[model samples]
Each structure stands twice: as C-alpha cells, then as structure tokens.
Target: MKLIIKSLIMILFAAGAYAADEPDMKAGEDIAMKGTPEGATACFACHGTRTEENKTGSFPRMVNQSQYYILQQLKDYSSGARNNAVMGPIAKALTDKEKADVAAYYAKILFPTPKVKKAASAVLKRGEELAVVGDLKIQVQACNNCHGPGGMGMAPAIPAIAGQHANYLEAQLKAWKDGQRKNSADLMGPIAKRLSDKDISALALYFEQVQINAGKAVAK
Candidate 1:
C-alpha cells in the first residue's frame, strides 16, 4: 500500500508539471480576441472566429492548422523568410509563449466553410486537372501530391487548402511565383513559376470548392 501511494504521488506531480508547461489556452483566446499589448493585431480581425468564416478571401483560414505548422509560419514571418507587410510586424511583436499559445488556440478549433461563388465549369475542370493530375507539359506534379488528396493537408508541415479562400490561394501562388515568399522556395517556387495567371485562378477556385470536414482535413 505504501509503495502504491508513493507511485501515485509521483505520477500526479509529473502530470501537474506537464500541464503547467502546456500553453495557457485561455490566454491564447484572449490574444486572438484582443491583440497583444506588444503591438500585434487582433488575430480575429483577419483570421475570424470559430463561428465565423473569414470575411474575405484575402485572409487564409487559420483554424484547422497544426500547432507546429502555425508556429513555423509565425517564426518565418518574424525572420522575414515569409515576408508580408502585415504579418511581419505582428509576428515580431509576439513573445515566444504568445506565439505558442496562439498557435495552440488555432490548431484545435475547426471552423465552418463559408459559401463561395462557383467558378466556370471549364475553369474548374482545368483546376481539377492541375490538382488531381498535374500538367505533363509543365512537369508540375499534382497539387495533391504533397497537399494530400482533396487538399486535406498532410499536417505537421503541409496546410489544408481545401475549402480555403480562393483569393488567398491565388495571392499565395502569385507570391510564390514572384519570389516574394521564400518559405517553401524549393518546392512551391518552381511550381508557381510554371503556372499561368489563368491556371492560378482556376486552381484557387477549385480548391475553394472542395469539401473539408473538421480541422483534421477529412474529405466529405
């Protein structure tokens, strides 16, 4: 009985310490709703809330992202590897724990997809071809090759693009092509460079129409 009690005590103490080290989710929620005093903008202003989809396609949906992926992006923004006029300042302002907390907050929530305008069937067909089967002429692999089937995202590194905002997707592709975004330079850089403006538009619209369930990237 004495040995069992001692073991239980040790286990409880370890669990308490582990929980203490974990990010404070309530603090994260506060940061999201209200920007940090460090000069970061309120994430809700751009990323939206759990109940609301992003107001426009200009912003990428933040929910459903993995914590590691979110953290890396924040780090990249701060380091200028992924330069953005808006995100650069925001990322720089966040302390390390704040970054972790916010990442944790977004990673766990699954937001609903907003209704989006449909693209022309022809355009969607072309986009589907690009996403499902890459164009041999350009030697570009299917977007799904890395993003996972249905753009559900492979997690840890890749982001789910299915049901993402078309405008945001277009913007990112353009950024990659223009060499303005260097985070995934070796991979997305080459692919985006090969895509024409029309192709980019089609791909973006197609992905925006894909059905994604939950934050885990399940296909509907």
Candidate 2:
C-alpha cells in the first residue's frame, strides 16, 4: 500500500516537471513581437514578416527551428560561449524567461523561401565536380554525403547551409578550418581539417548560391 502511494506521488512530480519546462507559445509570440524589456528591436524587424524583404542578410532566418536548438543558441550567446560581437550584447541583455519566450516565438515562425541566381557556367561546373565527386588527391568527401544534395541540413544538429550569406559561410568555414570554432561535431572536425583554404572558399561560394524550398521539414 505504501509503495503504491509513493509511485503515485512520483508520477505527479514528473508531470509537474514536464509542465514547467513546456514553453507557452502565445506568450513567446507576444514577447517576440513587443521587443525585449529594455526596448530592443522586435525580432521581426530583421527576420521579416510573411511579406517583408530581408535583403541584407544581417539576420539569419530563425523560423521553423527547433525550440531546444534556439534556446541553446541564445544561452550560448548570453554566456559568451558563442562570440559574435553584435549578437553578444543583445543576447546578454535578455532575461532568462525572455530568452525562452523569444526562442519559442522564432521557432514557430515560417521559414523563408530562398531565391538564388544561377551560377556562371565555370563556377557551376567547378562546384558540381567538387560537391559530387571530390578531388581524390585532396582526400575530401563529396559534400552531398552530409549536407544533402540540395544543401538542406540533416536537421536539429547541422544547420541548412544553402542560401546562407556568402561572407558568413566563408568566415565560418575559415573558423572551423583554423580551429577558432570548436563547437562542431567530431565528424566535422576531421572533415574540416582535410579541406584546403582554396577548397573551403569554393565550397562556401557554391553553397551560398544554392537554394532550398522553405517550409519542408529538415532532417533531425
């Protein structure tokens, strides 16, 4: 009889814990739309609404991301684990609750469709050769093995690289190659280590020009 009572109590406690962790989606939207308590700009201003133009690529699209992933990134920015000068200040200013709220809000937004101009014949030919066949002399794997044929990422872990800003992609690839960024997966470390500077530059340029359909579920 005592064991049965204890089991019931434990179950109730677990239920309460789950409820506490679940984000309130509506409240998150409100906070995201209204701005952080310190009067920072609303996220939509940079990410764009359903019809707005997000031309500068100053902000990466945040829509349709996993809430857990978004929360982790915000915390990383806030704690100085991820170091982007512009984002660090903004992230540091947010309260914990506000961080969760904004994460949920962005995760619920629709992902933006990408539009890319066709590459020049020479560039496209080079990119296709490298992405599909790899250069045997360099010992590089075909990019499509991990990044997918269209550059859609494998999901919650790998980010979609298609249509990311060319400059941003180049910078990140350099960081990874030089060991300046250490947060990547074990597989990524070795793969990045094998890439030459020129190879990295070409791959980044190629991916920046690739496009993917928005609103489709990414691999997770």
Clash tally, candidates in order: 0, 2
Name the candidate that leads on lDDT.
Answer: 1
**Which digits, one per residue and each the tens of the lDDT, describe model 1 over residues 112-197?**
76777778899999999999999999877799977888887766667778888889999999999999888876667788999999
Stretches of candidate 1 above 4 Å error?
1-21, 214-220
Give the candidate number with the greatest TM-score.
1
- The parts of candidate 2 lying over 4 Å away from their true place are 1-20, 39-41, 129-136, 185-190, 214-220
lDDT of 2 by residue, 1-220 (tens): 2443354355345434532256677777766666666755566676666555366765675644555557767777778766777767777887877777777777666655566555566665666567667777766667775555656654443456766655566677676677666454234555567777766767766776765555442211
Candidate 1 deviates by what RMSD? 10.8
Native-referenced Cα lDDT, model 1 = 0.82
**TM-score of each model, in listed order:** 0.86, 0.70
The per-prediction CA RMSD against the true structure, in angstroms, equals 10.8, 9.8
Specify the poorest-scoring 10-residue window by lDDT in model 1: 11-20
